[model samples]
Target: MSSHSHHTIRQAILDRIQTGEWALGELIPGEAMLADEYGCARTTINRALQGLANDGVVIRKRKGGTRVCDMPVRQAKFNIPVVREQVEALGSVYRHQVTRRVEKAPPTAVQKRLGLAPGTKSLQLDTVHLADDRPFAFETRWVNTRAVPAILDAPLDEISANEWLVQTVPFSSGDVVFCAVNAGKDVAEALGAREGAAVFVIDRTTSLAGEFITTMQLYYREGYQLHSQL
Candidate 1:
C-alpha cells in the first residue's frame, strides 16, 4: 500500500466495484478516506477517481460526491477537436501561427511510437492557437511523411495543420491519451501560463491501413476544460 501508484489504485478500485464490494450506484469512498486506506496521497487517489469518471465508470458531483454510474458506458469515442472550430464556437476570433516547422529526424521516442526506421525523416511543427488574440493551446506534432506526404504542401501559417489534417486526411484507427502536466518553459510561453502551472495535454496518433500518420501533443492554456458526452 505504501508504494502504490495511482494506476494500481485505479485497478484496485475497479476490481472492488466488479466484485460487488461497492454496489452499482453506490457512493464510493471519498478521496481522503481512500488515501488513508491506500497509504498514498490524496492527489493519487484523486487521479484514480478522475480516470474512472472520464471512462463513465463513476459520476462526480460537486456536493453529492462520487458514485458508481448505474449503467456505465463501456465504450466511448472522442473525435479529434479542431482548434479553430473550438475558438469560433466560443464566439471568439480564431487564429494560429506556425511558430516552427522542420523536416528532420524525429526523436527516438516519437520514431518508435510511429514505428519508423532509424533516421527516418518526420515533419515537425510547433503551433500556437489563439482565441481573440490570446493564446489558447500549443500544438507540437511529428508527421510521418511516408503516410501523408501531402502535408508538406499545406500552408500551415495560413491555416493550422490541425484544421488541414482533419479536413483532408482520413484515418481508420487512432489512439489518444489525456493527462495533466506541469508547464515547461516552451509550453508556458506559448500558452501564456506561468512555468510549472498545471496544463491539460492531449497526446494522439492516427493510422490509415496500418500506416501511422502522425503523433501530436496539444497543451492547452490554463483553465481549459474538456467536455465530452458519454
Candidate 2:
C-alpha cells in the first residue's frame, strides 16, 4: 500500500465514528479484521487508530481493544488560513503591520484564560492586517516564551506573528471561540472604524502536546464572515 493509505483509513474510521455507525463505547473491529476489510496491512490500521486516539476520538487499550469514546472530546478542525492568503483570495493586496511588541505581565483575564501563573511574563504582539490598503482585521496575541523561545529573535516587523507562528510552531490541540463585539477605542482606531461598530472576533488558544503555545484574538472589520466545512 502507499504511504498515504493510513490517512484514508483514518478518514474512513472518523466517518464511521462521526456518523454513529460505530456507537459510543462500542468496540470496533480488531485491527486485523479492519485490515482484512480494507485490504491493507494491520500496521496501517494500527496507525489510523492511534491517530484517532490522539485526537480523543477513540480509546485504545492493549487488552480491551479499540472503542469509540463514550464522551468524545471532539476537536473542531478549523484550518486557520493566513491573513495574507485570505486577503489575496479576495482579489486584494495583502499588507500587515506590527504595531506593538512587548514583554510584560499579562492581564489577569489573560492569565486566567491561559491558566498562567500570576506575574508570568509573555511576549505580546499587536498587529493590523490590511486588504487593498483598508483595514481587514486587528490582532492581539500572547505567546508563552517558554514554549516557543524562537519568537524572541524573530523579526515581527517584516513578517506577521500569525504567519511566523504558523510556520515555526507545531500544535497538537487547540480551542476556538467566535463572538460579536463592539469595537473599543484600540480596535476601532486600528480598523479605521467608529467606536461601537460591530466586529467579528475569533479567539484561539493552541497547545503542543499539552503545553501552551499561544493565544490569539483576531477582530475583523464589519462584514467579515468565517467559513468552514465538515
Candidate 3:
C-alpha cells in the first residue's frame, strides 16, 4: 500500500511472511527501499521493523540489515487493558479513585529498572479500581515524567491513571510479569481483602523507542483469573 502507516506496513510484512514470500532466515528489504515502495518516511519503515523485532518476527542487525526468523517463537500476547472497559466487560459498573499522587524519589529497584539516575523524581500514583462498588484491584505506579510530561497536567483525581496512560501514551514495546503474592496491609486494604490473602499481581513496564515510560504493580482481588488466548 502507498503512504501506509507503520502499523499497516508491519501487517503487510507479516502477511508476506505468512504466505512464504519472505523465506525463513532470509533477508528482507532495507528501510530506504521499503520507504520508497510504501511512499512513507524511512522512519515509518524503521518503526514497523522494530515492532516485528520486538515480537520475535524478524532479526535486525545495525550493519547486516533485517531477516525473517527461521523459527518464530510462540508467546502469549496481552494488550494493556483499560480498567473501565474490563469492569464493564464483566457486567459490573466501573468506578475508580486516586488514593495518592505525589512526585517523589522512587526505590532503588525502580530507579535501576527504569535506568534513571538516583533521586530522580517520578510521578507516583496509588489507586483503587472498583467493580460494582466493590474493590477490584489496587495499583501502585511510577510514571517517568521525562518521557510523559503530559501526565503532570492530567486530572488524576477524576480519571484512573490506568485509563489516562492508555489514552495519552503511545508505547512501542512492553514487558508483563504475572505472579501470586500474599497481600500486604496497604494492598489488602485497597482490595478490601483480608491481610495475607493470596492475590494475583501484575507487574508491567512499557517504553517508547528506547526511553522507559512507566512501571506499575497491580494487585487484583483474591481469586481473580486472567483469561487470555495463546
Candidate 4:
C-alpha cells in the first residue's frame, strides 16, 4: 500500500471529530488500531493526532490516551471574543482583509517578542478584522523566516496568518497574553474607533527550543470581551 501523507491522516481524524464519531471525552483508538482502520502506518496516525493536540482540538497523553475533551481548549476561545466568533456573534458577516505581507529584518516589536537582534529577517503580515463591512480589529503578525521559509509562497486573505502558520510550522512551546489598552490612531482607524479608545489587546509568542517561530498582536475594538469557563 502507498504511504499516506500526514495531511490525509489529519483530515480523516478531523472528519471523525466533526461527525461525532469521536464524542467528547471519548478515548481515540490506539495507534495500531487506527493504523489498521486507515491502512496506514502507526507513524502516520501519530503525526495526525499530534498535530490535533498541538492545535488544541483534542487531548493526548501518554497514559491518559487521546480523547475528545469535554470542553476542548479550541472551543474555549469561542466563549472569548475570538476574531471569527466575535463577528459571527454580532449576526454580521465576518471578513478578513490583509493589509500587507512582507519579508524584512525584524522590527523593534518583533525583536522584543523573539529576543532577536537587528539583522534577523522575518515575515510580517498585517491585516484588518471586519464585521459587516466595518472594521473591528487589527492583526499584526511576524513569523521567523528561518523557522517557516515556505511562508514566502503562502497566500494572504485566504487564511489567517496565525492559523496558517500554526498548522504549517510546529512549535514546541508558546505563550499568549491578553491586556486592555488605549488605541492609537492607526489601531483606532483600523478598528473604527476614536483615537485613545479602550480596546482589548492580545499578544502571542511561539517558539521551539528557544528558537522563535512567530509573534502576533491582535487589537480588538472597545466592548470586546474574552471569557472562558472550566
Best by lDDT: 1
Each model's TM-score, in the order given? 0.67, 0.67, 0.68, 0.63
Clashes of 4: 1
Candidate 2 residues 46-152, lDDT tens each?
99999888977678999999987654123336776589889999999989988989999899988876678999999999999999999999999999886777788
On TM-score, the stronger of 1 and 3 is 3
Model 4 regions lying over 4 Å from their true place:
1-82
Please write out the lDDT profile of model 1 over residues 129-230, one tens digit for every residue. Answer: 999999999999999887667778888888899887765554546799999999999999999999999999999987643567799999999899998765
Ranking by TM-score: 3, 2, 1, 4
Error of 3 at 67 (Å): 23
Q: List the residue pairs that clash in candidate 1.
A: none
List candidate 3 segments past 4 Å from native.
1-76
Off by over 4 Å in 1: 1-76
Q: Which ten-residue region of model 2 has the weakest summed lDDT?
A: 69-78
Error of 1 at 32 (Å): 67
Show where candidate 2 strays beyond 4 Å. 1-76
